[model samples]
Target: MGALDGKIAIVTGTSRGVGVGVSRQLLLAGATVVGCSRRPLPGLPAAEGLGGVEGRAEQWVCDQGDHRAIDAFVQRVVDTYGRVDILVNNAGGTVPTPHAEDVPELVQQIQSSPASDDDFERTVAFHAYAVQMNLISPLWFAIRVYRQMRTQDGTGSIVNISSGAGHPAGSPSLVSYGAAKSGLNHLTRSLAEEWGPKARVNCLALGPTMTENFRAFVLGEQDPEGRAYFANVPLGRAGDPDEVGRTCVFLCSGEADYINGTTIEIDGGMLPGVLYDAGLKTITDLL
Candidate 1:
C-alpha cells in the first residue's frame, strides 16, 4: 500500500507548475486530490496511471487570492470529502508575469533601484497574498482537518511552499515579497510550536527552481543577462517540478510526523555566494 493510502487532499493552483507536480505525486501515493486554479477545471490535464502509483484528482476553478473564493473552494472539499486529510495551500499570487518584451528589464531594474511604492505594492501583493493562500487558507482547512483527524485518525500535516527570497538569497526589489515569505517561514515555526505532535506544519523555501514563470524568462533567453543569472546556480540547472512534488509528498506522509515547524531549504544550495553572483541583493548591498 502507499504511504497516503485512503487520504483526501486539497492542492491549490493545480493548473500548472508545482501544483501540477505535487498533485500528481500525492495521487500516486493513493490520495483523492481536490485541486483548484483560476483556470477552467475542464481544461486540466486528465489522470494518468503510473506504475507503483494509483490516484486521481478532481478540479475546481477558484482564484485563491479572493477570500470568498477560498472559502467556497474549501467548503466544496469538506462537503464532498467529509473531511480533509492533507492541505497544500499554494495558490501563490494573483498577478501574472508579463511577456518578456514588456518586462525584459525587470530583473535589472529591481536590482539597481531602491524600492518604490509601486514595487512594494506589486511584490507585497504577490508575496503577502502568498502567505494568505499558503498559510491562512490552509489554516481554515487545517482546523476542520484537525478536528476530524484527531477524532478519527489523530494525524494531519500542513505544508507551505516558500521561496529563498525570504532567506539569505535576499532579493533586491522584492522587499515586500521577501518580507511576506519571511512571515510565512516564521508561521511555520509558530504553527509547529503551537500545534505540535497532532497537526504538523512545515515550509519549503525553494530557490532558482524551474516553473512556468521561470521558463518564460529563461527558456528563450536571447540575452547575456539572462544567461549570467542562471550560471550562478550551484546545481548548474533548474529544479524539476517532480523534485518539489516529491518533497511535498514526503512532508505529508506519516514518516514526517516528527518533523514539524521547520523550514527546509530546497534550492541545491543557491544562497549566499550563489545568489550574490546572480546579482540579487544581500546585507553587503544594504551597507
Candidate 2:
C-alpha cells in the first residue's frame, strides 16, 4: 500500500508549478487529493510508474487570499472526504520586474533603490497573504478536521511551502516575498507547538525550481539570465517538480510522525557556498 493510503489531503495553489507537483505526489501516494487553485485543473495526470493504484485528484477553483472562499472550499473537501488528513499551502510568487538591475542606476543604490510601495504591497499580498491562507485558513479547516480526528483518535499533517530566499539576510528587490516566507517558517513552528502531538506542522523550504511559469514569465524568450542562474547552482540545474513533490509526500507520511515544527530546505545546496562569490556586488559595480 502507498504511504498515504486512505488519507485525505488538501493542496492549495495547485493549478500549476510546485503546487500541482505536490498534489500529484499526494495522490500518487494513495491519498484523496483536493487540489485548489485560482483556476481549476482540467484533469489529473496519470501516474506512470505506480503499477495499478491510480490515485484520485479533484480540482477546486478558489482564491486562497479570500478567506471566505477558502473556508467554503475546505468545507467542501471535508464534506466529501469525511476527514482531512493533510494540508499543503503552496500558492505564492514574486512580483514581476525587469532584470534585477535593468532600471536606471543612481547614487545611494542600496538605500534608495529598494522596491516601491506598489511592489511591496503586491508582494505582501501575494506572498504574505498567500501564507496567511495556508496558516489561518488551514487552521479553520484543521479545527474541524482535528475535532473529527479526535473523535476517531487520529492525527494529521501540515506542510507549508517556504523558500531559501527566506533564509539569507533578505533580498531588497524581493524583500516582502522573503519576509513573508520567513514569517511562514515561524508560523509553521508556532502552529506545530499549538497543535502538538495531535497534528504535525512543518515547513518545506524550497530552492529554485524550473516551473513553466518561471520559464515563460521570468526567464523570458532568450533565458540568458535563467541559464546563468542555474549554471551557478552547484547542482548545475534547477530542481524538478517531482523532487519537491516527493519531499512533501515523505513529510506527510507516518514515517515523519516524529518530525514537527521544522523547516526542510530543498535547494540542492545553493545556500552553503565555499567560495567568496560576490556576484551581486560585482553586478552592481558593473552597472
Candidate 3:
C-alpha cells in the first residue's frame, strides 16, 4: 500500500511548479488530492504504472489573496473529501521580477517613481498586504481543519513553503516577498506550538529551483544563462520539483511524526555560509 493510502490533502497554488509536483507526489502516495490555483491546470497524463489512481485528483480555482475565496475553497474540499489529512501552503510569490542584485537599477526606478496615492496603495497591497493572504489564510484553514481533526481524534500535518531569501538579508527588489516568507517561517513555529500533538506544522525553506516560470524569467526563451546560474549552486545544479515533493511526502507521513515546529531546508545544501566556502574553487572560477 502507498504511504498516504486513505489520506486526503489540500495543496494550494498547485496548478504548476512545486505545488503541482507536491500534488502529484501526494496522489502517487495514495492521497486524494485537491489542488487549488487561480485557474484550471492543463491536465497531466497518468504516471506510468499508476493508471488506476490517476483520476483521484481534482482542481479548484481560487484567488489565494482573497480570504473568503480561500475559506470557500477549503469548504469545497471538505465537502468533496470528507476530511483534510494534510494541508500544504504553497501559494505565494512576488509581483516583481529578478533578484535585486540582478536588477538594481530597475529596483531604484520603481522605488523612485512618483505615484498617485492609489498607486502607492496598490503597490503595498500587492507586496505587503498580499502576505496576510499567504500567512493568515493558511492559519485560518489550519484552525478549521484542526477542529475537525480533534473531533475525529486524528492527526494532521501542515507544511508552509518558505524561501532561503527569507534570510540572507533582504533582496531590495524582493523586499516584500522575503518579508512575507519570513513571516511564514515564524507563523509555522507558532502554529506548531499552538496545535501541539494534534497537528504538526512545519516550514520548508527552499532555494532556487528551476521551475518552468523561473526558467522563463531568469534565462528568457533561449535559456542561455541556465548553466551559469546552476554553476553557482553547491550541488552544481538546480533542484527538481520532485525533490521537494518527496520531502513533503516524508514530512506529512507518519515517519516524520516526531518532527514538528521546525523549518526544513530543501535547498540542496545551498544555505549556511559554509556552502560558499566549500565551493571556493567554483567561486573563484566564476569570479
Candidate 4:
C-alpha cells in the first residue's frame, strides 16, 4: 500500500508549478487530494505518467488572499471529506510589477530623487498584497485545517511551501516575497510548537525548482543567464518539481513523524555567502 493510503489532503495553487508536483506525488502515494487555484487544475503532461497512482484528485477554485474564500474552501473540504489529514499551503508568487508610467520615475528616484512618495506608496501596496497572499493566507488555512486535524484519530501534517529567498541573507530582487516567506518559515515553527503531537507543522524553503513558471519566465530558452544562475549550486542544476513533491511526501508520511517545526531547504546545497558569482570569486581569490 502507498504511504498515504486513505488520507485526505488539501493542496493550494495546483493550476501550475510546485502545486502540481505536490498534488501528483500525494495522489501517487494514495491520498485523496482536493486542490485549488484561481483556475482549474490542468492535466499533468503526458510524461508525468499516472498509470500506477493509487489515489485520485479533484479540483476546486479558491482565492487564497481572501479570508472568506479560505473559510469557504476549508468548510467545503471538511463537509465533503469529514476530515482533513494534510494541508499544503502552496499558493504564492506575488512579485509586483511596477506600473509602466512609474518605472522611469522609480529608476530616477533610486539614483537621484530620494523622496518619491508615489513610488513608495506603490511599492508598499504591492508588498501588502504579497504579504496577504503568501503569509496571511497560509496562516488562515493552517488555523482552519488544524482545528479539524486535531480532532481526528491520528496526527495531521501541515507543510508550508516557502522559498530560498526567505533565508537570512534575503531576496534583494524579491524583497516583499522573501519577507513574506520568512514569516511563513517562522510561522511553521511557531505553529508546530503551539499545536504539539496532535498536529505537526513544517516548512519547505525551496531553491530554484524547474516548474512551469520557471520555464515561462525565469529560465526560458531565450534567457542566457538562466543556466548561469545554477553555476554556484553544488548540484549544478535547478531541482525538478518531482523532487520537491517527493520531499513533501516524505515530510507528510509517517516516516517523517518525528520531524516537526523544521524548515528543510530543498535547494541543492546552495548556502548563504556562496550563492552569487561575486561571492564565489571572493572565496576563490582568497585561495
Candidate 5:
C-alpha cells in the first residue's frame, strides 16, 4: 500500500512548476489529489502510468488569488469528498505587473522627478497583489481546509510552498514577492501553533528548480549568465521538481507526524552571501 493511501489532498497551481511536481509525488504516494490552477488542467506528462503508480489526480480551474474563488473551490472539495486531509498551498509566483515590467525605468522616473500620487498608488497596488497571492491566499486555503479537517479527521497537514527569495536578505528584483513569501513563512508557524493537536502546518522555502518557465527564461543558451550562476550553488545545479514533491510527501505522511510549524529549506545547500561569484571563481580556477 502507498504511504498516503485513502488520503485526499488539494494541490493548488498544478498547471505547471512545483505544483505539478507536488501533485505527481502525492499521487505516487497513493493519495487522491484534486489539483487546481487558474487555467484549465493540462495533461500529465510525468506521472501518468509510470511504474503503474495507482494514485489518482484530477484538475480543476480556480483563481486562487481571489478569496471568493478560494471559498468556492474549498466548498466544492468538501462537498464532494466530505473531508480534506492534506493541503499543499502551492499557488503562487512572481507575476509581472505594469509597475514591475519596467522597474528600472519606473524607479528612475519616480526618483528623478517629482513623483505623482498616481505613481505611488500604482506601486502600492502592485505590491498588494503580490501579497494577496503569495500570503493571503495560502492562509485562506489553510483556514478553510483546517475547518473541514477539524470536523472529520482532525489530522490534516498543510504544506506552504515558499522561496529562498523570501529570506530576510531578500531579493532586489523580487521585492514584493519576497516580502509576501516571508509573511507566508511566519503564517505557517502561527497557524501550526494555533491548530496543533488537531492539524499541522509547515512551509518549504525552495531555490532554483528546473521548471518549464525556468527552462524557457533562465536555463537556455541565451542566458549564459543564469546558467553559470548555478555553479555557485553547493549542489552546482538547480533542484528537480520531484525533489520538492518528495519532501512534501514526507511532511504530509505519517512519517512526519511530529514535524510541525517548521520551514525546511530545500535549496540543494545553497545560501545567500555564503556562496556567490567569489566562491565560484575559486572553484573554477582550481579546476
Candidate 6:
C-alpha cells in the first residue's frame, strides 16, 4: 500500500509550478489530492502523469487572501472528501500579474525600491488593500485544517512552503519578502510547539529551484539570469520541483513524526559564504 493510500490532502496553489509538483508527489504517495487556487488550472487535466500517481485529483477556485473564501474552501473540502488529513500550504506566487506570489520577484522589488511606500504596500497586497497574503493566508488554512484533523483523529500535517530568503542571513535584496517568510518560519515553529501530539507543523525553506513560474520568470528564455545565480550553491545548480515535492512527502510521513518545529532547506546545500569561499570555478572544474 502507498504511504497515504487512503488519505485526503488539501494542496493550495496547485494550478501550476511548485504546487503542481507537490500535488503530484502526494498523489504518488497515494492520497486523493484536491488542489486550490484563485483561478482555474490552465491544464491540470493533461498534467496528471507526474510521478504516475493514481490517486483521485480535483480542483477549485478560491482566493486564499480572503478569510471568508478560506473558510468556504475548507468547508467545501470537508463536504466533498469527508476527511482532510494533510494540508500543503503552497498557495503563494508573485501577485498583481493578478496572482498571489509564491516567491522570487518580491525580493527584487523590495531591493529596487527599499524606501518606497508604494512598493512595500503593493508587495504586501500584490495589487490593492493590505491582506499580507504570504504571511497571513497560511495560518488561516492551518487553523481550519487543524480543526478538521482534530475532529477526525487528532492528527494532521501542515507544510508551510517557505524560502531561503527567509533566512536572517539570507538575501538582502528580498527584505520584505524575506520578512514575510521569516515570520512564516516563526509561525511554523510556534504552531508545532502549540499543537503537538495531535498536529505537526514545519517549514520548507526552498533555495533556487526551477518551477514552472521560476522557469518562465527567472531562468527561461524571456529572462535568463543564467548560471551566475548558482555560484553560491555548493551543488552548483537549481533544484527540481520534484525534489521539493519528495521532501514534503517525507516531512509529512510517519518517519518524520518526531521532526517537528524545524525548517528544512531544500537548497542544494547552498550555504552562505561556503561556496564562494570554496571557489565556484575550482568546484566546477573538478566536477
Tens-place lDDT digits, model 3, residues 90-147: 8765434333223223332333322334544445444544466556666666676677
- In the range 17-104, model 5's lDDT, one tens digit per residue, is 8888898898888888888987774544345666664436678788876778888988888888777899999988763222344333
Clashes of 2: 0
The true-structure Cα RMSD of candidate 3 reads 5.7
The all-Cα superposition gives candidate 1 an RMSD in Å to the true structure of 6.4
Give the candidate number with the greatest lDDT: 5
Q: Show model 6 residue runs off by greater than 4 Å.
A: 42-47, 50-55, 95-131, 220-225, 273-287
Can you tell me which runs of candidate 2 are displaced by over 4 Å?
45-55, 96-152, 222-225, 272-287
Instruction: List TM-scores for all candidates, in order.
Output: 0.77, 0.77, 0.81, 0.84, 0.84, 0.80
**Candidate 1 vs 2: which has more lDDT:** 2
| Clash-forming residue pairs, model 6 | 92-101, 92-102, 93-100, 93-101, 93-102, 94-101, 94-102, 95-99
Which candidate, 1 or 3, would have the higher TM-score against the true structure? 3
Q: State the lDDT at 35 in candidate 6.
A: 86
For residue 133, give model 5's deviation from the true position in Å.
Answer: 1.1
Relative to the unseen true structure, what is the C-alpha lDDT of residue 254 in candidate 5, on a scale of 0 to 100?
Answer: 93
Q: How many residue pairs clash in each candidate?
A: 0, 0, 0, 0, 0, 8
lDDT (10s digit) by residue, model 6, range 218-263: 4445235546667667777778777888888898788787888899
Model 1 agreement with the true structure over 133-227: per-residue lDDT tens digits: 54565555455445555654566778887777777555544454565677778877887787766678888877766676555533433432346
Q: List per-prediction Cα lDDT, in the order shown.
A: 0.65, 0.66, 0.69, 0.76, 0.76, 0.70
| Local accuracy of candidate 2 as per-residue lDDT tens digits, 1-287 | 89999998887777778876787788778888877767655654323344444446777787765667866887787678777888887776653322333332231132122343454443334434434543455555445555555544566888888877576666554445566677778878887888877788888887767787656544445553565556666776778778898998999998888999999998878763311131322223323
Name the TM-score of candidate 4: 0.84
Those runs of model 4 whose alpha carbons end farther than 4 Å from true positions after fitting are: 41-49, 52-55, 96-121, 220-225, 273-287
